[model samples]
Target: MSYSTLSSRTVLVTGATSGIGQETARQLAERGATVLLHGRTAEEARAAADRLIATTDVEPRQLHTYSADFAHLDKVETLARQVAAEHPHLDVLVNNAGIAAPERHTVTADGNEVAFQVNFLAHYLLTCLLEPALTSDPGGRVVNVSSALHRTGSIQWSDPNRTRRYTRVAAYAQSQLALTVFAADQRVTAVSVHPGVCDTALLPLYAHKGISPAEGAANVVRLCDPAVEIVNGAYYDRATRVEPAQAATEDRTVKRLNKLADLLVSRSAA
Candidate 1:
């Protein structure tokens, strides 16, 4: 299903200050898409955008910077509002912001496990808030940069935070699983991709060495193209579509996760 070139599209990529997110923004901007670069702080966001212009042929007009600490839900809400207000017709949302679960179990001020909030919940809230802009156009969609490790996760319904039994790996996996399942949501056209084990800060979780962030970002940028038709809820390992963990595609699990996320995000906002 061929559509249009990115030259006419506007995309917002979270976590663009570094790693895959930064590379994704760079690639998209190079292809003529208006890329919004989000970072943990305003200074970081501006710095990433500056570095892109300095090192690449990308023009300053092609980039915009935004910042919000995902550790806080209110900040996520604010970020969404600013983007939606500034760009009414967002063509793509790359939910690429994430962090490895710290060795010591840590909870955000929002009351969610740090990794879970930063990796999944914040994206969930941002996506929901941006629904209007996403659906304003016919081809708009979401690309979730999930992980293969999601297969190792299970949602602890009784205690989502795993406050009783916290392990860094488990906590991180659960967040990725929730993100993968979220693609099944009927509210929007969305897909998740495990962009291979990239040599980013999170690489230690997968291997001693991995591919470059630009290589992984290519897989993500491909999905953003309207020409590369996608099935809603599809999961991809790099550029090949594949089944996600069984639970990720289950309708019951999707609904359950939505409920859990709604509660978690609303509670934090309240």
Candidate 2:
């Protein structure tokens, strides 16, 4: 089922040039909802938007593009301001861009771990900057793309920055957990989806896990569809019945997680 009944809603999708993101943009456009396509490069973002317009009834002006490498929080901030200034009444934000690299302990420009900043912090800052627009409607949706990796992950309160220690899979898992908790803490209706192991290049983060990108994208799109609007703060997979996340369900736990993120961002800014 289509998520928006507004006939003309604006949706922004990150990492939209490839994989699940590309597919979600296509599906959303086909449903007649405007979609803002996001990618790392300008050419790629524009091309992806153009392709969707060609194949779907999406109005040409309805499809927009924003480019930024998630490796830098400055870029995410810039993108948020640019988007908000351009489209003042954004109705949805799919914080879906993610990357996993096993070869090193990557860091963003702010010196935060790469996976933590790109996969998690970038979304956090983006949502915070756009809070006015989201809360304006109260019914606005924020669909966060977390993962099932948290089943094996735990919050490392002592070292979330991975300043002293880091493992590729562990850091990736930790970031997903952090993102889910953050979503649950926000005022607007927010939910996280763990697109099960899919054949996306994202799996190479584990150096072996694999599943088709289509299968991976299924859940992300499901969470965005209007049918699940009442599923605020829930975790979902595909179109299955919604489920509560352990962290989201636990008040004290989510509070702590938010506190940690707050401290990290404060220090990072300092």
Candidate 3:
């Protein structure tokens, strides 16, 4: 699919150092979009950017790199600020950075579960901060890289942060669920996507069963296409729109999650 509309647009893809995110950046650049490839560190980001420029036919000037550790909310804030300052307008924001179920439960310096922060909250805060840039254009889109596993998740209101007890699967599900709900609640053209279990490092054991990173990225690139009109707040399974878990569709739940997310980000900034 040719995304001629993307020519001259600015896009930011988190987790572009590898997997679906990297492929998504490459494909977008091929469509003539200026891509901001994000990684956890400057070296990682630069390396990824260089590889894209060298391997793809896209011009070197079309690719840029930015780095921030999502585990620390403060760093996420810094990333948002830097992007806003550097780019006058952001046409697309791909919240593709994520971690799968970890073998052991871990907490970040921000006092939140690692999966929750990295997979959901960081993108939430980043999108909030970048709203101005996104809305500056008429067709601004925020494509959140979510998962079909979100159907298995329910918010643990009692322990949303997983401070008391934690399981890798539960934490991962909850984070993705929150992300879907946030997409639903956002006023902008935001939508969540399930890349259909790509073979990424996030799930090494399941690598044999899932599709290739390029296939997963195709679905994401489709959503970013300016010609496609997105059903605001909907969850997509590749090219098809599918229903998420019942909890993800509840208005009360979406509101609650948004409130909690705001509080978390505000606290981290403080």
5-58 in candidate 2: lDDT tens per residue? Answer: 534667889999988888878777776767889999899999998887787677
- Kindly list the per-residue Cα lDDT of model 3 for residues 1-270, writing each as its tens digit: 545657877899999999999999999998889999999999999999899878878898998899999999999999999999999689999999998757787888988888899999899999988888885466688999998778888778778888777778888888988888888875678899998888888665334678889999999999988788788888899989988778878888887887788777774432
Q: Model 2 off-target regions past 4 Å?
A: 1-6, 135-139, 205-211, 242-245, 267-270
Poorest 10 consecutive residues by lDDT, candidate 3: 201-210
**Highest TM-score model number:** 1
lDDT of 1 at 221: 93
In candidate 2 the C-alpha lDDT for residue 189 amounts to: 78
Candidates ranked, most accurate by lDDT first: 1, 3, 2
TM-score of each predicted structure versus truth: 0.96, 0.88, 0.95
lDDT of each: 0.93, 0.76, 0.87
Worst 10 contiguous positions by lDDT, candidate 1: 1-10
Where model 3 places Cα greater than 4 Å from the true spot, the runs are 2-5, 204-207, 267-270
Candidate 2 lands at a TM-score of: 0.88
Q: Give the TM-score of candidate 3.
A: 0.95
Look at candidate 2 and give me any clashing residue pairs.
3-225, 3-226, 198-211, 199-211, 199-212
What's the lDDT for residue 194 in model 2? 76
Return the TM-score for candidate 1, rounded to 2 decimals. 0.96
The whole-model C-alpha lDDT of candidate 3 against the native structure comes to: 0.87
